[model samples]
Target: MAMTEPTIVPESSAVSVSVSGAVVGGLRDVPTTTLADLLGRARVMDVVVRPLWQPVPRVAGPAFTVRCPPGDNLMLHAAVHRAAPGAVIVVESGDLDFALAGGNVCAVAQRRGVAAIVADGLIRDLAEVREAGFPVFARGVIPIPGAKSAVTPLNRRVRCAGAEVDAGDVVVADEEGVVVVPAARAEETLTAARARLAQEAAQSLDDWEKAHRNRIDALLHAGGHEES
Candidate 1:
């Protein structure tokens, strides 16, 4: 029996639409916590995919989702070229045995103006990635390289870090974690997040104490505790 080479799918096969730059730019400063709060803490990605370095601020942009088999990075390679300048490449690799990205890919993605990368898989070439100053959040690091034989689809809805991400969805990642805001709800979500942030910023210690005291008093009163 002879082995057959895998077919490389054209970039057009993947469904992706460039999100408006204004929309993506508006979310540049929106914190992941704010987005999480807007979503009721439901759309945040798992904590496993953490930033490779500390003190790195936030990265926000439209998502360019990639669904690929573990140990294969062909789809990711394709996505890097197809993604919009400010898009964040989100990869859903099932396992961590193989490193799906490394220094070379980071350099290419950086030169291409990719906002960042968030993968539910391992990556290698930490030194190079760090030197390139590309923001990457992933499960962990591994020395083993991945195969490029499989050509996975790009820009489709995919589950990454236990969260479902769709192409054009707003991805906001910070020191805390990553959160997704559905494209359809970006405007309203942004409004709500801004309001919430303002409210939190204006809240004083006295206000917090009063709110906590009121809650505790209500609980005690409901339990029939009488004050002397």
Candidate 2:
């Protein structure tokens, strides 16, 4: 018998199986506000990445984290192809001078069924991205493309927008901002978010006003400025 070489598999292939679709779906219905409240409003990303256009829908999915060198996007290109369907591609590009991705990248990601793209950097091709209707959340937009000399890591823990995000962390984003919920806390946080949503829905405007007044009264009393 002749000797044969074994196949070499990429590391990203291993990460696609780490998180289950059910786990990702659990967060699909949970609003970012509810998740933020349940997590003590702590894990929220800085309010830098906003929707390219107004009224973009909410996005929730497990993170497929990538850490590319500042102004480089080679790893992001690899990640887009390997990330599991419905995974949110989270990239930590350390600068905003150049774009890590553009409209064409968004098109491919959408075809691959990616839930969304969140970059702690910049992106371009806004006109096409808007037309494609793909959800992209990033710090800003730029016209220049970054260097691709560096080989970045994929499916690993990365700091994005000043927050620590592990590969399987659930990311929820809406009109307001993005929040990263650790994988270990997903179930508990989902339950709490559901309860909070229900509680908010059942509260009436009058009840909210009453509560607001009570809080203001308490504050005034504490400051010794309560009205006569």
Candidate 3:
């Protein structure tokens, strides 16, 4: 969980990058499968909050990240306006309190072609978020409202999901958990993650067979004793 200083993300690089919503689209994707294979190599803490949001229809691009202050969403709106089509917005709401973003904001993101929203704070209006099929992940849910003063700065480096997220960082989240790949290191990390997944998938198949055999053996042994 090492955090480095915030780095500036240029709007142009993000805007022109090919939209690759399938960046880590399915559990079968290289980086995703690699994460699954590594198992303990990834800590769930690295994924902030409850994994309970409904799946939003995905579009495409790398991820765009932003850090916001607690209970204030000025920067969040800014992030939405500037976010690239395939970008996922990651917000670090200090202390994990307050409802920083909700349905109306999600609607805005949807219109802007944003892919997903991840907040360390609560989000309200589940129905609207779900209805729009906008993917959202947060610490929990609350009925609270947030102030809109644009107090926090946009596109700064901040910590979320036990990892540091700066603008242009790659964020991939699924039912398993979320992982951050620093922009500078994503290409290498993705290659590594895919390798780990292939090795792990083979191991998983072997383990499942072994466990099944053990269960059958125990059942047979108990039947023999009862018959005798």
Candidate 4:
């Protein structure tokens, strides 16, 4: 069956106020994968993703910000024109109630050079979205359509999973998971994350050897006691 576009409910939504240069250049440089590693390191609530039903093929990209109400996707349609190459649109739905993204948008996003779509709400049109093959991570996939009555301010700062994301934030997603790094924090995060990865890599062999030796010694010690 052909996938149909979901109806979006429009609402009177407002964009968060930002002072000069607050969200400007808010795009971060840390690899999206690096942030996922850091989250594992610190046990932080860093991995903020909706639900993963279908997998979007891995691709490189920057983040485009859009704030919308639950079930409203008006602003998202507008963002398609403003998106840059390798851009991923991060939709912050006010509450986790509506299906904010779906298949039709996925087709448009891919055509506009979007790398992925991350939404805090549900998504519809799973088969087409997967067929289009634009990476999408949402709360889950629901057959329900979205409401278009509420307003969704484009290129505004909005809270996503306790982290504030603005337009142009660097988004990286892969098999491990999704991570958002602020433009301001990218350099530092990347440097530190790289160092940590290198250190772990260098020590991995030694650590494994040590564990093997310990296991052998423990087993020998048990055999000796039994013989005695």
TM-score of each: 0.88, 0.89, 0.69, 0.68
lDDT of 1: 0.83
Across residues 9-122, which tens digit of lDDT does each residue of candidate 3 receive?
344343222323344453225443354344333323354554555543222235565666777766676778888676788888753556777788899998888778877777
- By TM-score, the best candidate is 2
For candidate 2, list the clashing residue pairs, or say none: none
- For each of the candidates, give the backbone clash count: 0, 0, 8, 19
Query: Which order, best to worst by TM-score?
Result: 2, 1, 3, 4
Best-fitting candidate, scored by lDDT: 1
Better candidate by lDDT, 2 or 3: 2
1 against 2, candidate with superior lDDT: 1
**Deviation from native of the Cα of residue 187 in model 3, angstroms:** 1.8
Worst 10 residues of 2 by lDDT: 6-15
How much lDDT does each candidate structure score? 0.83, 0.81, 0.63, 0.62
Relative to the unseen true structure, what is the C-alpha lDDT of residue 143 in candidate 4, on a scale of 0 to 100?
78
Task: Give model 1's TM-score versus the native structure.
Answer: 0.88
Against the true structure, candidate 4 has what lDDT? 0.62
lDDT of 1 by residue, 1-228 (tens): 998877756543343444566766777678887787779655899989899877666998888888779778878877887787888899999667888888898889989999999999988999998877789998989999888887765676799988999888889888889998888888777778778888888999899899999999999999999999
Model 1 alpha-carbon miss at residue 42, Å? 3.2
